[model samples]
Target: MIGGILVLAAMLLTGTLTFWQQVERALADNAYTFANSYLDMAVTLAGVLMVLRGLVYVLRMQRELRNFKDDTWSCLELLIHGLRDDVRSIRRHLPIMLGGLLLLGLLSRLQLILGGVGFNDGWAELILVGIGVLMVYAFFRYRLQVHVRPRLEALEAVRRELAGDSLKPDDL
Candidate 1:
């Protein structure tokens, strides 16, 4: 494997061989094939950030209305308005996300080749990237445990109160 890499590296640097240039071009050709998908991922992420923003906005508006002694209707309207806007935002990004994901599936085969897995061509790269994504998710969820678990646990008390289940903050 090391020997094969050394040979390929030499060929890429030399440029005396047309084959190496062709391979490089092939690898780089669909650079934007996944651009939209990546953008879609960003847009989806912004939706989560917006939830926090909306919560702040709602709380501020609710507090301001309390001064006027007629806050219920205003708060409800603000919540509904924010929700509608968020739903529209998410809906708008759906097609972009789907298109981008489809492109990722087509273009992500580069992963296996770059990762030095010995897969030069074909659908194996796509499958490998899929497996890679799953492995990454599992690592984050189980091994690293770095994502959503903490937030969920922290909110457990609120969730139980909302459901009228209990007032215990034990999980937190």
Candidate 2:
């Protein structure tokens, strides 16, 4: 999925560059306006794709959660596993998201500097700052999880003891 997204983004970028070149060659009266419109469409499409991807991920997670057995200990274990997976997923994607945002910001700034209608500096800065905030938020959540997991495991241990079951190590 990530590969497909990257490929599509690259294709859109290549097409945009090609179109800009053609517009430059033709020197049409509304070339910049048309180019800007096309760029906007491409960016909008990318945004929509990202939102859809996130929605799908959330739905899938919900479905998986629904499948677990309806026992407290099992549910707790599932939650611990889910948190670990969530952290891993975030860690894997954070860099890619950051890089993509930075690239987008750079492209927008370049377009502005080159006298083309493009995303304003404020918008780009806002996006970068938003990503930074999200990064920080994810980091804190991960720290909380790190601190919380052991306590959860201990609770699981106590539960097992009360149930006269031997404590077992988690496979996570």
Candidate 3:
């Protein structure tokens, strides 16, 4: 999912950059009217694409959750097999995520120090970082509710049943 978003963002940035270049060309040719129209169109198109991408993302997430709930036995099996590795992987990625955020901040500060003017006030990157954090939190919550807790409860029940069986006096 993150990969899909990154790819979409890259494509949008490419399209926007291409439109910006066309605007520059129009201005260089003294076609101010054409430049203004193209700039407006580019901004509008980018905004629409962003909104559409967000809607698609939400729809995809909902579909995934539904599918997950439908095949919870598979989810439980996966958790049983890989829960420890999943946890260790998450632990490893935490520092990477934090480092990426720190690097983003440092780069933004460095650009400012170098008298570089950005297109926006860095709010876009901050929002992306915030969303990433929220997604990670949501994933953990979902796993706990849907996978880990259920599996733990199942194991507990099995243990209790075994204990009760051992207490029976028939085959001793």
Candidate 4:
């Protein structure tokens, strides 16, 4: 709110950009840089998270082996417990992740609405801009999920296997 106002004030004071010029530049920036950077960051971060998830599983498995080399049940129990913790962590953090998506949607909509300033003077136009933003967000959400799905499936598989056959994996 205040931050947005301050940014606009800075732009005006600098005399380097009129509102329309800034809008055009912002459109180009968003089209070329912001979305691409956001997507790249998302993919990279998801990969990092998956790697960390795998590490947690491996570390716990190793610790279980070290502690209960002779106790098969304890090893399985530890493995299952550790995997459950990871699943729980994901469940707990899911809302925050979705909130980030929602916030991004709102910010993008605000940008679009601001850009459309001279073109349409009605609040109805603002609502239309918001709808467009949601459409864009939906596309982003689908694409991101497509990329992240396999990693999630792999994690879920390990969790399910541990839960279903905890006693057997301990032998190997």
Please list the C-alpha lDDT of all candidates, in the order they appear: 0.47, 0.57, 0.54, 0.51
Residues 114-146, model 2: lDDT tens digits: 774555644656465557647765774676578
Candidate 1 vs 3: which has more lDDT: 3
Higher-TM-score candidate of 3 and 4: 4
Q: Locate the minimum summed-lDDT window of 10 residues in model 3.
A: 33-42
The regions of model 2 sitting more than 4 angstroms off are 1-46, 70-78, 111-172
Considering lDDT, where higher is better, how would the candidates rank from best to worst?
2, 3, 4, 1
- Which candidate number maximizes TM-score? 2
Each candidate structure's TM-score, on Cα atoms with residue i matched to residue i, is 0.28, 0.41, 0.35, 0.38
Q: For residues 1-172, could you state the per-residue lDDT of candidate 1 as single tens digits? A: 4564455455434433443444455558765333223333333343444444455555656555564564544544544454444444444543354445446666545554565554554465455545654564455345223433444344454444555576466855
Q: Residue 56 deviation, candidate 1, in Å?
A: 8.8
TM-score of 1: 0.28
Across 1-172, the per-residue lDDT of candidate 3 in tens digits comes to 6676766677767767766776677567754444124324434444545555464555555554555565555544443444444444345654465455545555544554465444564545555655655676678667766875676667555555645765668755
**Candidate 2 or 4, higher lDDT?**
2
TM-score of 3: 0.35
Ranking by TM-score: 2, 4, 3, 1
TM-score between candidate 2 and the true structure: 0.41
The candidate that wins on lDDT is: 2
Give the CA lDDT, 0 to 100, for residue 127 in model 1: 56
Clash pairs for candidate 4: none
lDDT of 3: 0.54
Sum up the clashes in candidate 4: 0
